[model samples]
Target: MVFRPPFEEFEIQLVEVPAGETVPAPTNPGPLLLLVTRGAGSAAASGGAAASSKLLAQAELRRGSVAFVPAGTTIKYTASGAGDLQVWAAAVNAKVFAPATAEEAAAAAEPALVAA
Candidate 1:
């Protein structure tokens, strides 16, 4: 579903992935914040310039799990476990927020998944 935010600089989407399904990797034009609200899954980022296939992060999704993906990063998501994966994702312009630290920058550079 489409989500119209109070501000025009961003948008949110409700995404669902069937159990045992995977979504192909795709690059986004802006930063994306994905919050898993149900079920379980993993989101991975494809190695970029080096062409390496490495997992950036993984989590057993449940309510409040969050994943931050920076702009232009290619990401692949898989839905596993016993039920379908449901997530609330928000895409925001990268220019809107500035990384405050090296760690934050590093985290934002790849797929940083965290369980809540």
Candidate 2:
């Protein structure tokens, strides 16, 4: 997955996982923050097991859950049901790695004098 980090802003990524598919390993060791927007699923890491292999996070996420993935922790995911598993994920210090900037606008044209 690709995350876009804005200037003085957080990096964001939308993930949609099919049933029986797990999220890939972490390419980097960073703090991951996920917010469920659509479907639900289970998540885990090197420290613990997923929440539920069939349901979503009805209550608070456990330590091994996706919400508790600490820094330097290797992360992965597992789909719950046939429905999709959609989430919004972000990382800490994303802006530090790569930041965004605004583009400058062009100047207005000047009017010319004409003879009658």
Candidate 3:
């Protein structure tokens, strides 16, 4: 958002990937900002779509670690320890980026613009 609401784009989503569980995160709409806020975990990205995805890269994620997943990539997250793995996703032009109300535009613009 412009300091006064100009270019309102992108979304912020919080997700918790618990231990003993693996979840697929498909980021096809736009680039992703993966920030591990709490707990420890790991994420892996592949080369192809589901069922045939080849491992492209992997990362050991912990507190203060950040991952930049490109627009057309898929990443899997699994909590490593007892605590749940919490992630803050800031995706540009995806998720809750659509702002129908004037107020939403203001709130939405701040993060998107600042992130950019």
Leading candidate by TM-score: 3
lDDT of 3 by residue, 1-116 (tens): 11212343756667788786887876545667789999898888764333253333777889898887766666788889788898887776542344468886787677655543
Instruction: Give the CA lDDT, 0 to 100, for residue 12 in model 2.
Output: 70
Cα lDDT tens digits, model 2, 60-116, are 322233454455555565667666676667766555554334421122133356578
**Residue-wise lDDT of candidate 1 within 1-116, one digit each (tens)?**
76766775887877788889987544656767889988888876654421343444444566679877666666666888789888887887333554558886787788678678
- What TM-score would each prediction reach against the true structure? 0.63, 0.55, 0.64
Q: What lDDT score goes with residue 23 in model 2?
A: 73
Overall lDDT per candidate, in order of appearance? 0.70, 0.55, 0.70
Candidate 1 regions off by >4 Å? 47-60, 93-116
Write out the backbone clash pairs for model 1.
Answer: none
Give Cα distance to truth, residue 39, candidate 1, Å. Answer: 0.5
**Steric clash pairs (candidate 3):** 1-109, 1-110
